[model samples]
Target: MTDRELDEILTTRWPAVMRRVIGDDSDDWMQGFVKSIARHSKRPSWRPSAKQAQLMQRLVADLSAPPEPAMELVER
Candidate 1:
C-alpha cells in the first residue's frame, strides 16, 4: 500500500478499531501496541512492512465483524 493509504487507515480507521477492541480503559499492552503502530505514521513517508500490512488488514477485518456476545455469569 502507498504511504498515503497507510496514513489514512492508521489515522481514520485504526482509532475506531482500537476503541472497539480495547475500549476506553486500555491496559499497558494495548497502549504500547498503539504507540508502536502510531510511530510509523508519525515518521515521514511511512509505509508498512509486509508483516505490518498483514496485521493491519487483520485489524480492519475486526472492524467489520460484529461484537461477540458478552458471557453472563451463572449463579450456581
Candidate 2:
C-alpha cells in the first residue's frame, strides 16, 4: 500500500478501535502503531503479506461491529 493509504488507515480507520481498546491511551498506541508500520515499510523487501492483509481486514471488520449491550447488575 502507498504511504497515503497507510496513513489513512492508521489515522482515519484505526482510531475508533484503538480508542475502544486502549481507552485514554489510544493516541499513544496509535502513534506507536503508525511508527511500526513506517519502519516496516522502509525495509527493501517489505510488503504486506497476504496473511497480514487478511488479519488487518478481519480487525477492521471486528472494530466496525456494533458493541454488545452492557450488562446491568440486578439487586436481589
Error of 2 at 27 (Å): 16
Clashes of 1: 0
* Residue 59 lDDT, candidate 2, scale 0-100: 56
Off by over 4 Å in 1: 24-31, 70-76
Question: lDDT per residue, candidate 2, 1-76, as tens digits?
Answer: 5666655666577656455545545567555654465467567566666765565556567788887999999999
Deviation from truth (RMSD, Å), model 1: 3.2
Indicate the TM-score of model 1.
0.63
In model 1, which range of ten residues has the least summed lDDT? 17-26
Candidate 2: C-alpha lDDT = 0.61
lDDT of 1 at 3: 68
Cα-based TM-score, every candidate: 0.63, 0.46
Name the lDDT value of residue 35 in candidate 1.
Answer: 61
